[model samples]
Target chain A: MEQSKKLSAGILRNDRLMADGRTIRYYDTSGQNRSAKDARPVEKQPAIGELRLDPLVNEWIAMASHRQGRIFLPPKELCPLCPTTGELLTEIPESDFEVVVFDNRSPSLRPPTGDWALPDQVGPDTDLGSAAGKCEVICFTAEHGNAFKDLTPARVRVLLEAWIDRTAELSQESFIEHIAPFENRGEEIGVTLTHPHGQIYAYSYIPPRVEKMLAAANKYKTSTGKVLFDEVVAREIRDEERIIARNDRWIAFVPYAARYPFEIHVAPLNPVADLTGLTDQDRDAFAPIALEVMKRLDGVFGIDMAYIAAWHQAPVRVGRDVLRLHWQITSVRRAPGKLKYLAGSESAMGAFIMDMRPEQSAAQLREVVL
Target chain B: MEQSKKLSAGILRNDRLMADGRTIRYYDTSGQNRSAKDARPVEKQPAIGELRLDPLVNEWIAMASHRQGRIFLPPKELCPLCPTTGELLTEIPESDFEVVVFDNRSPSLRPPTGDWALPDQVGPDTDLGSAAGKCEVICFTAEHGNAFKDLTPARVRVLLEAWIDRTAELSQESFIEHIAPFENRGEEIGVTLTHPHGQIYAYSYIPPRVEKMLAAANKYKTSTGKVLFDEVVAREIRDEERIIARNDRWIAFVPYAARYPFEIHVAPLNPVADLTGLTDQDRDAFAPIALEVMKRLDGVFGIDMAYIAAWHQAPVRVGRDVLRLHWQITSVRRAPGKLKYLAGSESAMGAFIMDMRPEQSAAQLREVVL
Candidate 1:
C-alpha cells in the first residue's frame, strides 16, 4: 500500500539569496498529514537534494545527501504514480479516459475530500527537477496481467496508434525535446503496479547516452559511408545467426555487444527518427509482430516473460533523418528463477558477457509457432 | 514444470575448420541432467544447436535451428544447471575434478553442455578447439530460496573472497584477457535460476562497453587533470547530496547519470584496480558496509529487495591502472509497489530519467536511522 497519509505538502521557502558560501539549500519539513483524499491541488514537497543543472548534458540529476540510501528495492504490485487513495485507488486522466491520464487525480484514484495538506517548505526542485520536461503515465490496459503480448493483433495495432498519438501530442509541448516511451514487465524487473501501463518522459534536453550513440552513428557514417546499425544488421542477416524474429518492417536480433544476457533489438527496415514517421500500416503491422514477439518470448520459456522494450527514436524537432529507429528489448529471464545479478562487471564497468549464444536464443524463438 | 521432453543438448565443432564455413554447429537433443549437489561422470547426448565459432569475437555461439519455437522461459524451480536425471550432455569442459565446469544444456551458455541421457558424438574441433575462457558456477548456498542477498554478510564476504581468489587465479591463464563476474537476481531481469549463486566468466577480450567507459574516463582525465569518478565523488560530498554512507576508507554516492532509479555506487577513497589491491582489513570493512547498505535498503522498502551490487574493477592484466575500482548497487524499486522500468530511454538509447529527487530520497532514508 502506498502512503495514503498526505501531509500538508507545500514549499514555504523561496529565499534564493546566498545563505552559505556553498550552494546549500534549506527547507522546512513541517506539514499536516491528512488521510482524506481531495480534489484540491496537492502542494509539492520541499526539495531535499540539489538538482545540479548539467549544461553539457543538459539534464537535471537528483543529487541529494541521503539519496543513495533511499534507492530502495521495489515491491511487487503498487504504482508510485498513483494518487493517495484508500485501498481502492483512483485512476488517471480525469477525462473518461480509455486509459487514465490526468492532471488532476482520476476519480477512482483520488482520496475522498480531505483538509488542505499544506507543508511548511519544499525542495529547490521536485520531480527529478529537469527545470523542463513532462513525466506522465500511459495506461496500457485496464486489466491486470494484461500485456502487449495478450492483445489481439488488431488490438495491439490500437496500442500502437495510442503510442503514435501520444508521441505527436506530447511532442507538441514547447518545453519538451525528447519523448521516451517504454514499458517494464515482471516482478524481477521490480514493477510496482501490476496494471498494464507504461510511461512517457519528455525531456528538455538531449541525454548524454543518446548523444554518445548519435555521435557514434554520425562518426560511423563519416568514416564508413554507411550507417553502422545498417551495416551491422546487414551482416547479421547475412550470417543468419542472431535473428530472433522478423517482418518486412523490422528484424529482431541479439546485439553483438549485448549488455544483458538476453538482449533483443528490433530494427526497422526503413530508418525513421521517432514515431512521427511511423505510418498507420507500419504500426498496424507492428501489432502481430509485437504480440508474436511477446508470445514467442513466452513460448521460448513456457512461462510469462519479463522485458523492457524501449522505443529508441530521434530527439524531437531535431533532423535525425539519418538515424535509424529501433526497439531494444532486454529480458531478465535468460535463466529461469535465478536472475543475472550483475555482480562485479556488467553493473560497474559496463562490461557484458552473454552466457547463451544469440543463435541459440533465436532458434529457440523460431521453434515457437506463434 | 521444465520441458521434460528434452531437446538435443549442444555439440561443439571447435576447430580452425569451424571458421571455414559461414556458420557451423553441433547439437545434443538428449542429455542427462546433473545435480550440482552430486557429481557424476556420464556420457552425454548431442544437441540440436551446434556450437558455432565467432572468429572476430573469438567466442563460440550456438546454432540451434530446432530451438526456433522452443520456450525461452526458464522452468519453475528446475534449474538447467542442475538436472536430476537424463541423457548425458555434451560440450562440457574436459577437466575431471572435485567440480567440473560444463556448458549449459540449453545450447548457448558458454561452450554448450551435452547430456549422458542421449547418445553423444564428438565434433570436428573438439580436439583442436581453443576456448576463450572458463564459465563456472559457484553454488553459494544449498537452499533454493536463499540468494546472495539472503546470505549473511559473513557469507557475502566469503563470496567476495571467492571472487578475488578466482579472479586472481583465472588472470593467470595465458589465454584469458578479462575476468567478468556477475549475478543476476529475479526472473524479471531474465534470471532463470532459483538458487543463490553467481558466475565468473573469463573472457579473451575487453568488451566494447568497458572500452567505451575507459575511453570516456581517459578523455575526462585528459581534460580535467583528475579522475572522473573522484571528481564526481568530491562534487557529491561538497553538494551533500546523493551520498548514502561514508567511512574513513569508503564512500557511497548515487551518480547523477543514474540508469536505474535507486542506483548507488560504493567506492574506496584510494585509487586501485580490481579487488586485488584491497587490503584484508578493507575486505573485512566491506562486510559491514554490504550489510548496512542492504540493511538500509531493506529498511526503506521493508521487503526482499532486488538489487545488483556489481564490482567494477580494472581489467585483469591491462597494462594501465586507468579506472578506479567501484561497486554499483542498483535497485529498480521506485515507490513501494511500483518499479522503475528500463523502458524507452534507458534500455534503448541509454538515457535515464529518475522520478524522485535524490535529496528528498536521502533525507527520507537518512531519517530512517538505518
Candidate 2:
C-alpha cells in the first residue's frame, strides 16, 4: 500500500492506501508517529453503479443497488469506523487518530477509470452515464459516542482545515463539477452509523438545487450588478428578526422562506466561492459559530436535533463568481415524536408547505439558552 | 347554508355550505337522498398563510404556522372524514356517500378574496404574496377502516370522476395555475388521518417538479417533433421489463430512472393534458388499472405499502399540449421496518441515490402474487 505524509495549517496529514486499494487519510493537530498497515484480507468491492438521467426532470439518479447490503446501526464491538484492535480489524488501521477520511466502502460514485467518463449532457437516446465521481467519509473524531457539538473548537478547526484540503484536492479532478460536504446525523435521519462522521460527494454534474441557486444568482447578478449572496446576507442583517446567532466571520439565521420546520443558514460575512477560497483566519473563526448554532438547534425541543448539515459551495467548473459558500442545516423533526415527511406535495411536486413560520422558528431558536 | 343538487355521468352530486361557510360536495353512485347539513358549531377559521418566494431557488414556500395545532391521528370515534351520525357530526354531512370533497378546515392555500391575488411573477423586490388557491379533502369511502385498494372498481370510478369535476371547476378560477390531486396513504407517510382520503391542491403557480417536467417536454418536442409523454409510454412498452401492469387506456410502469426504491408511473395510452380531457370510456378503464397497480404495490412486501400517489395534471394556463396527465406513486419504504430517508445528497442537493434498480423493482412488483 502506498503511503505519504505532509503538514499543512498546523495539521499533520498521513495518506495511505487500504488493502482493498481504497485511499485513507488521517489528520492530527499534534504530530504523532503514524505508521499503520491494513493487514486484513482484501475484500471484494461492490460493483460501481451507473447514473441514469431522467429526461422528464433533467436530473441524474445514481442506481447503487449494491448499497442495500451496507452496514446498518451495527453494535459498537463490530463498528467498522472504530480504530482497529489486535483481534478486531476495522476500516481504520491506526490505533488512534484525531480525524480521518477514507473512500466509502459502498459508494454511490467512484472515480472514473478506463474509458468511464461522465457525459456532459444526456438526451432521450443518451440517458445513462458512469456514476464517476468520488465519495469519502470524514470521521470527526475516533470517539464513538461523542457528537459534533461535544467537540472542542480546536478540533473543529482541524476538521474544517481537513475539509479545505480535501476540497482543494478533489477539485483537481476534471470530471468532478461540484463538491458537497455534508453530515446526516442521528438515527432519525437514517444514519446507518452511530459514529461521528460526515460525507463529501464529488458530483460529475451540478446538482439540481445548486443549479437552481446558480441560475438565480446569475439572474440577480445580471439584473442588479450585485452578488446574490451578499444581498441575501445584507437583507438578513437588516431584518434582524430571523438572525439567531452571528460572529465576526459568520452569521446564522433562519431563512426568510424556510422549507423545513427547523432550518438555519450559516453564511460567511466575507464572500468565498468555495471552501478552498477560505482564509486560515476564516476557517478558524467558523468553528465556534458552527458549534454555537448546533448547540442552539439541539437546545430547541430539548432533544439531540437530527439534522442534515450541508455545505453549499460553488461548482468547480462554473458559477464560481455568482454562487457563494454557505452551510444549510435542516431538521425533519417538527415536534417531539413527530416528523415532517415529504408527502404527496413535497415528494411528487417539489412544493413545500412549511408548518412553522420563519420568524417564530427564529425566535424559538434564539430563546434557547446556550 | 346554500344547497344545490345535480347529476353528472350517472352519478348524483350535491353541494352544500358548512356552518363555517366552506363548500362540501358529495358524489353518490346509488341514488340516495343526500340532504344532511353540517350543523356543528361554526369554528373560527385559521389565519391564511402567505406564500414567500425563495429567490435562491426560484420557488414559493407556504408558511402555515397555524397548522401546528391541526389534528394528528385522532381516534376512530373522532375520525373527521367519516359520515356524520345523528350524535356526532364530522366533515361529511351525509350518512353515506361514495365520494365526498370538502374545503380543508386548515388550508395551506385559500381562494383569493377582494384585493388579494397571486402575482404573475415574483422578484427580489416582491417576494411575498397571498397563498391564494383552493385546498380540498376527498374522502374515498364512508367506511373508516377501508383503504383505497379495498374500494370497489365502481367506487374508484366515481372518485376519478369527482377529481375530473373538481379539476374543471378549479380551472375556472383565474388565480389557480395548476391543480393536483394526490393521496398520501399510510401512517408512515405522515398521514394525520387514518380515514381513506386524498387531497386536491389548486396552486397559484406551477409546482417545481411539474415545471421541470414541462420544460423537458417542451425541449423534447422542439428537438424530436413528437410528444415526450407519448415517447416515454412507447419506450416503456418497447422495454417490457419495467412494465408491471397495463390496460388498453393506461400503462403502469416503473420509470427508466426511478428515484425511489418502489415507484410506478401510470400514464394514459392517449395524450390527455388534464383529468377533464379523459373520455367516459377512459375514466371507466382507469379504475381497474389503478386498482391493479395499487394492489401489486401492496403485494410487494405483503404489507400495506405506504405511498404518495400524485396525479400530475397540466397547468391551467399553460403546457396544455406538451404536458400529459400521469400518476406518479412513490413509496419511501425500502423494506419491511426500514425506510429510505432523503439524506444529505437528496434533501440538500436534490441528487437522488437509489438503493434499488428500477428494472429490478419492477420485476419484484411483477412477481408479487395478487
**Largest TM-score belongs to which candidate?**
2
Candidate 2 lDDT tens digits, A1-370: 4555564567888788898999899888778766788989998999989899887877889989999888899999988888999878999999888989999999999988865565655565566777988999999998999889999998998899888888998999888889999999988889999989999999988899999899889988888888888888888899899999998888999999899999999988998999888876788799899999999999989998899999999999898999999999999988888888889889899999999989998999999999
Per-model chain B TM-scores are 0.67, 0.97
Please report, in order, the local distance difference test score of every candidate based on alpha carbons.
0.52, 0.89
Residue B155 lDDT (model 1):
54
lDDT of 2 at A42: 90
Top of the candidates by lDDT: 2
Name the TM-score of candidate 2. 0.98
TM-score per candidate: 0.61, 0.98
